[model samples]
Target: MAEEDAASKRRRLGQEVPSGGGVGEDGGDPDLIGRLPDEVLGSIITLLPTTDGARTQILSRRWRPLWRAAPLNLEADFGSLTLLESERVASQLCKLLSAHEAPVRRFSLKCNGRYGLSQPIAPLLQSHRLQDIQEFELYVRGDLPPSLLSLSPAALRVLHICSRPESPLWTTSTLSFPSLRELTLVDVDVSESALHGVLSRCPVLETLLLDNIRARRVRINSLTLRSVGVSDCGYPWEARLEELMIVDAPLLERLIPRVPSHHLVIRVIHAPRLRTLGYLHDDIPRLQLGTMHFEKMVLVRPSDGMRSVKILGLLSAPNLDFVTGLLKCFPCVEKLHIVSYTQMIFKNDVKCYAPLECLDRHLKKVQIINYEEKRADVNFIKFFVLNARVLESMKFVVCRDKCGAKWIARQHKKLQVNGRASQRAKFDFEADCSRGPSSMVDMKHIHDLAMDPFDRSSCRCHGDALH
Candidate 1:
């Protein structure tokens, strides 16, 4: 019978050979096409599922023409397909990416719903083998087809355009990019010549982030901007910033040319490379301190003429006589941090001068964080144990649990029975639940009373030693 027809033609070539070994038993895995690497076997036949990324050349004659020299990631999901099946799969992947001549780095499209913006993204922005388009993400939430802002400065670094603030492509105006660095404009209603025509055409721009953008007038003179972050700007911006961060410029009262009705103002004239001056505003009208040289100075009102400060932080100025007239404008302060806020105390304005008897000749270390025992905080800690004279340490931080820790242990047993120099004052008391309902007391009596903690060297024969 002709040897039974050669055993039924070797059992129909072992059922055409593809059970993970093509052509050994005569089916198809020549060690999976010698473990694929012509761009990883053309990205595994371009991720097979359009009946296999369009038939992966019948999966082996070494994936025949490896997806025609692979490098095309044409994506179109059009959210559940069928705007005529996403324009017939974007016109057959733009005719197989214009007969592919090898380089199409990445082109992604996810047009959710309303996909009608004159659909020809100029064949991937006029592709001449696309010279390095790293990432171009467009999430068109309606109205972006004025020829997609005519993009083709080619070599685009990173551009993210998110449209829909009431999309008429958000009023487009000739935005050109000549080798863009990085740009992000979110929630756009941009105008002010389209934000100075995209910062005068992105001249190798470094970093600019504008959120909730609404520009009616913004003139920034950038000398190669280091860092600029403008938040919620609805207008009133006249910039010459080197490092300016203005938050909620509600109609910003004044910063340049001294408009001081305060929300935050930093005017450092002859600013010798100003270090740090931070103010978090609730109400700021006039906080002007020019002729400045800072190491660290933080003031929240009680306007001053700060002159060469070392370290000063005073928060919640309940006008302690206007903070002792702004500490006579810092005549060389070493260290002082006094933060008291409970709407700054006013039960008939209960006393507050004792800024250590008005800056007792350059006070050393006085830290009172929320100390509320109040005879104006023990007459501001007994005027820093009677006029600073090099007071090394005084840190009283007892922030009221209706403040009466047995009336502060009966005022330390009535200052150790009223005499013996109030038991040689070098106080220390700490029970801080991290700044609320506090109790932190530390006073290393100044002028080196031999580094007094009541001068105790194992209690130096226990107290009464301040001769």
Candidate 2:
């Protein structure tokens, strides 16, 4: 009777049932996953969360002893636990570390203490099992102990620390990152000299991200850095990062800034190999690149420009002079992306402006995200449509709710589809309501965004109208 009932459920769910024997008994397929070698199974188990990895003991007989030998992945979040509960869990974690014989590979701890009770994570980090940890992430609500930053492991590659609201008071004179390649620090307070010292200690550092760091001034001088991102440091009224000066970075390729305000002054004194830059906005009061300077999105001196810059991003209202003037500083740009949230209204044509090197010969692609087909928006696109002689493709990404067949047709006419300067230029329209206008460069994927970070032409397009 029980076999009949179980067979009925399997049939209803469209599952295959053996006719002559139970599953894996005689006629059914064998358990392939359980047949895997213990080493492979142990590696897979270590990738799971701490609790989930331990729970695998009940999966089957083969998986019972695997978790004990797998490399540890210890993660604890005390935000939901009460004071007593959190202490108990912390004690259990300590005991587990003492008993576990395998090495620790990944450790992540995030917590918001209550009633001024903070859990000390320094002891866990100092454990012998964690000496070879490769990745570590710590996000604490209160101030962190000075000892946390002093520990230097030769095997550590990635370290992300976020101490919000309150910053750490470092007593250590120097912090070392021997093998660290990617480092991200958020809301931590470090003096100008101490910040420089931190960079000096990282010998092979490749990617560095500073987010909302509470420092009066941040200076970067690195020898082996490839990418650097400074985002959301602070506003004008706050006593946070006011000046970001990249004094010297020989191999720097990409420099990205997110949510930059007028209060932040960015100066790139020397970066000869800089190839990708911006999300350049008019809100930034001042930006100094090499010898050229920009005051509120206007290039003060156009004679000095970086020929190495091939990709550029801009966030602004419909101001042709501002865009044209800025492009002069990057003469060899191959791809250009512009993101606009406010309605664009161009009052006049592309006045008596000289020909730009990028538009005349090098420029190949252009994209305008959040295109609304406003008179100025179309006019802004028309400048590139008519002048970019070497252009091969142009795309206007519109929101789904504001796009349709009729709207697309009207845009083709307004843009003068038949009179494009580049005879090979293909115009396309894509409607995507999922996301608003945003730059292509994201800080999370800093290393992967190498050259043409703003180019998203590879993504599938909807409502594509090509001519």
Mark the regions of model 1 whose C-alpha exceeds 4 Å error after superposition: 1-82, 89-91, 105-132, 135-139, 142-156, 165-180, 188-205, 211-467
How well does model 2 score by local distance difference test?
0.75
Question: What's the TM-score of each model vs. the native?
Answer: 0.22, 0.83
* lDDT by residue for model 1 (323-403), tens: 444456655555565555555554323233444433555666655556665455554455445555655555555543333
lDDT string for model 2 (17-69, tens) is 64333335343554556556787789999999989999999986667778888
The clash count of every prediction, one per candidate, is 12, 1
CA-lDDT, candidates in order: 0.46, 0.75
Model 2 alpha-carbon drift over 4 Å, by segment: 1-47, 52-69, 114-117, 120-122, 167-172, 232-234, 348-353, 423-428, 432-441, 449-467
Best candidate (score: TM-score) = 2
Candidate 1 to native Cα RMSD, angstroms: 23.6
